[model samples]
Target: MKQHLKRTAEYRISNRRMSKSGIASLSHFLYIRQNSLFDIRCWTFDVRRSLISFSILPG
Candidate 1:
């Protein structure tokens, strides 16, 4: 009856909240992962450039 309806509403609200938080956390994780990958790419590029310069200087 009324109590059952109330319980159902509460359950739905909680489920919606959980899904929102889950999406937020997932996007946060992806953002961090993307930044880390970009950093790694930059680091690798810098290292390769330095190596080329060093080799040219020796020659």
Candidate 2:
């Protein structure tokens, strides 16, 4: 990955507490930069999974 991509990934990782939609947006932005190297839609899939899992688990 390029320096900018690495930086963006770092930023996205740092926003772990952000909303799923926000996370997807950031991931999509990074995906576009990667020239389709990363599948952001798939990333959002994982995010949705996490959301569902979180909703199922006890608080």
Candidate 3:
């Protein structure tokens, strides 16, 4: 799964750009641990850098 996220992140980095990259760059911020939960704290930082706009997703 980590490999998958890395691949997806790599792909997003190459294909997606600022503002729209967030959706694709989800791989970079997503986390699924042994506790079985996805945590996304990078949203604030990413948004400030124009790397993504998670406003569309559930808040």
Q: Write the per-residue lDDT of candidate 3 for residues 10-44, one digit (tens) a residue.
A: 88877766647776566555533422441344655
Pairwise lDDT winner, candidates 2 and 3: 2
* TM-score preference between candidates 1 and 3, better one: 1
Count of backbone clashes, every candidate in sequence = 0, 0, 0
Rank candidates, lDDT, best first.
1, 2, 3
| lDDT (C-alpha, whole model) for all candidates | 1.00, 0.83, 0.60
lDDT score for candidate 3 against the true structure: 0.60
Q: Mind giving the per-residue lDDT tens digits that candidate 1 earns over 1-59? A: 99999999999999999999999999999999999999999999999999999999989
Candidate 1: which stretches are off by over 4 Å? none
Question: For each candidate, what TM-score against the reference?
Answer: 0.83, 0.35, 0.27
Residues 1-59 of candidate 2 have per-residue lDDT tens digits of: 59999999988877764777798899999878896645777788899999999999976
Pairs of colliding residues, candidate 2: none
Q: lDDT of candidate 1 vs native?
A: 1.00
Best by lDDT: 1
Worst 10-residue stretch by lDDT in candidate 3?
31-40
